[model samples]
Target chain A: MSIFFSLFAGLGLFFIGIRLVSNNLRQVIGRRLRQLIARAVTGAGSLALFGLLAGAVMQSVNAVIHVLVSLVTAGAMDRKRAFPIIRWANIGTSLLVLVAAIDLHALALCLVGLTGIAYYQQIDQSTRWRHAVGALLGLGLLFLGTDFIKSGAALLRTEPWLRLHISELGLWLLPSFAIGAAVAWVAQSSTTVVVITMSLAAGGLISWNGGTMLVMGAGLGSAVSAWNLAGRLQGSARQLVLFQVLLRLQGLLLTFIFYACNRWLLDDPFNRLLDHFQLGLPARFAAFYMVVQLLSDLGSRTLEKPSLRWLEAWAAPSLQENLSKPHFVHDEALDEAETALLLADKEQQRLLACLPAYLDALRQDAPAALASADKRQAAESQVLQLCEQFLVELADRQRSRDVLERSMVLRDRNRLLGSLQESLAELHQSTRAVMSDPTVAQLLDHLVQSLHIVLETLAETAALAQPDAEELELLRSLTHDRSDLMDSIRRRLQGSDLEPGLRQAVFSATTVFERCVWLARRYVLLLDGPAASPDHPK
Target chain B: MSFEHDINDEQGTRLVSLKGRIDSATASAFEQATQDLFATPNARALLDFSAVDYISSAGLRVVLMAAKRAKQAQGRLLLCGMRQHVREVFEISGFLQIIDSVADRSEGLRQLNA
Candidate 1:
């Protein structure tokens, strides 16, 4: 009973430590980590190094993949750039399993002592070092947990009842592998399972061959966990998860082949090679885990292209994702400042064309909106942001004053477009909210129709190569101030016998409409150029 | 809802009278009814909305599209005989300022003829 208690306590401490370290360390690194990921993709090599670094810090490839998925979704890092990093992170996660091979009882004591003092001295409450302190405490707990697990396994090995069962279990390779896979799936971390297996092997509770099967099974189990974790993810995010799963399967297959050769034909060359290092059973198992990860990484590299194609077919990007990506701006265009600016303008024009789709849900005559307003809005915002980044890059590279001035104007217009999209989305929601009210149905219908016309006109005018002065004047008139009309609607609502929620909806809808009109006018003035609008400040 | 329309040409002006509800279900026919009003260059037309009790956003969209086509063709379009509810729809949308309208058919015809 005491032995079972010790094992359970050790596992509890280990999981708690992992959770503490992963969650807080990310907070400690924060935006600098994200900035590094966004800006440092010079090539595959740098991406792999960063991926390895991320895996080592987080100690779980699953956690690292989650971070990469978010970055990909946000357009901060391309999925193609993230692929190599994910492959290498699998190897990097072996760092913890390797570290666990060596006994660190003294080091664990020192860490516990130091962090205890820090906690007593209130250092953990210091904002600057709080996460760092927590991470150190987690490291100490992790080491202590390792010590407890090793001692518990050593005690359990002396039991004749356990010895009889384990020896019988080790004789059947499939059972050993099945046990490891089941435990790993439950733990959601193969490293945890492998480390526990190492303790059992060192204590003479399991054979080296059994440990090898367990390690391979743990890899497969972790892959399953990743797939389950990514159940809600879509597009390239799902592709990354599939990539990770394939990488694990590839490693498992290679390791099984090597195991078969060693067991049947080759006079145990695999174990013989590990025997050359003079490592104990625990270190040997750790070495075996590392070799499997390395084999997976190497196998994945040779098959990377075809594997990516397969993943793409399996999880093709959704329409929203394709829409969100910038179609015109590319990094190669940045070398030629004028071309880059032109491409940015073209992308902005595309975004403008998408604006009227926000009201498609409210339009009875139109086909169903391509996506929900929020999703479409987010997609447009993503493209607008990319265009802004391209323009900023152009400005930085060009020393010519004329180029810089034009870039600045484009940036201003990009901001106005963002504001316009936001207002239109809000108006859509508010109008929808009141559309069912019998008293205000006609009013809501009119608002939707009027806004739709202005949006379509604005989009059309902006698409022209050089919008004539007459067309520009027409846009200006169409988007001119309608504050009086909105105010009259509000006053009528205030005096009407309507429910408070419906009344507020009407007021909110009118206010957003007014803002949408103002934003459209500002955009038109920007389109007309600063010289043409003396009354509006640049 | 149900909608019906009648189109007549008086001299150079085209007059259309609409009845029933102009909504999503009937907006297509409403649009089809006025398609030929601007077939000729600089055409003049009047739409009477007294018999129409309700106009939904879809119906308004068809009306807005017709007005834009008329402007593009360099033609004149006038709306008249709008019931109280229909006129409120126009006024609230700010379309009253962009498209010309009047209280009754006689005024709309006089304006178009003059």
Candidate 2:
């Protein structure tokens, strides 16, 4: 019972340690990490490598990928890039096995002391160093961890009905593996299992055959633990992890076959080379086990892509669209209204891109382009249709309190986009009406030129993930000019001696321009999101 | 803009019609519309969207600021005939959630005011 309690304590500590490290790191650098990774990761292969490297660096790619997945689902990244980045993340993920397998068989006390001291101090470096040291200390604990495991095995050996069957190396390996895998899975730490296996073997408490089997079991058991944790999260994530495990399991099966064929292959010629050496049984066992782990880790990630692709094909539709950063964010999900809002926004923006081209075609009277304009029109039709669908769904939802408010915002935004077709028609009519008046016509033409520049900037703004400061300032300036024009038009309307018809007409034209400006600002606000926008462009 | 809504014995039925621009200068019109409904016996009103063409922050304010007014009156306001320009103004400002909207006066008058 005491032993079981100690084992539980050890496992509890392991979970707490990983959680502490991951949480603090996230607090210190969570939001920026996504931006950084997005900026850094480009090519698919490299992105995958980045994912792996990030996981290795953070000691938890699971956490980083969670952030990435959230951003991606929020319509943040190019789909093509997201796919590749996710694929390569596995490359770095495989390295954890290597981290767990390393023999940190010394300096456990110093690690704990340093970590304690670092945590006590409030300096920034100390805190950062504390996490790093805690990880190292955790790595160092693996050393004493092995000692504890050996002690456990020693205690087990003394028990009266202890079951230690002596059989061929491969035969005994399966049972050893079964025990090891179960231990690692339950403990949620392959490191603990590996060290425990090593300690017992080194202490002469378990045979090399048993030790080797535990190592093999550790490989299989890891997926069990990972899949278990994966199931707790969302998206196609659990499915993706399961798919990844299938690939790893295939490697395990292959390794198991090699274990069976070991005697045949490593017989006399292999025996003679080792026979001359005075290597300890424990040392030889550790070396052989390490070799197996490295090969499996490297080979599984690299070679299993094709198989994973096949698995992914089966797995794609199986993934849930939870839109969460599964590993990090637990409950941060957009409600149906929000989901609809974002989807509608994206679809609307996509539709908006067609406006310039269509307007240009109409201006040039390009009949051929009218066919393409029809495509744009169809796109707009799709946007409006989607908006209605989203609105209908939004209407039906019983959202949470704050999100309810956000829902209103989304609904409003959708309706705002809905006004486009008719508003554009009015603008076109107003332009034609005002253009007929000789005095304002040239000014209107010039203003349209300027408006086009402003709109070009707006379009450029539309194209940009983030607009440049100078361009943003220019946009503000254009809006300011538009507002000024509004003021001037009002001033002109107020002048008493003017023709009543022209006065009304001028007033009407100003209103149309003002409306256009207003809508443009609204859509622009949508693009900038709810972030604080600078008042007016330069 | 000043707004008015009136709904009948359909319980949640009412109609609100407007008469001015909706901005800082004329935001009171919008407020008066909701306030006038609140002063009435009806618990529901359809907002006559035909007259209201422009909306600004101040206009949106009256809609949001008087949220408790309709509920206190045991009534609600449903917006109707929200021309695209007006609807876009509401949307960009995020007014869709606070007030119920319909295609026309009849629909607003019939839809649930609550």
By summed lDDT, the worst window of 10 consecutive residues in model 1 chain A runs over A529-538
State which candidate has the highest DockQ: 1
- Estimate, for each residue in A198-317, the C-alpha lDDT of model 1 and write its tens digit: 877867888887888888889889888778866877899899888998898888888888778778988987677877887899898898888888889977987898999999998998
lDDT of 2 at A244: 41
Q: Pick the candidate with the highest TM-score.
A: 1
Candidate 2 CAPRI level? incorrect
Per-model DockQ against the true two-chain complex: 0.34, 0.02
Which residue window of length 10 is worst by lDDT in model 2 chain A? Answer: A323-332
Candidate 2 local lDDT, A377-411, one digit each (tens): 43355445435544445545645554455445555
Candidate 1, A524: how far from true, in Å?
2.2
* Candidate of highest lDDT: 1
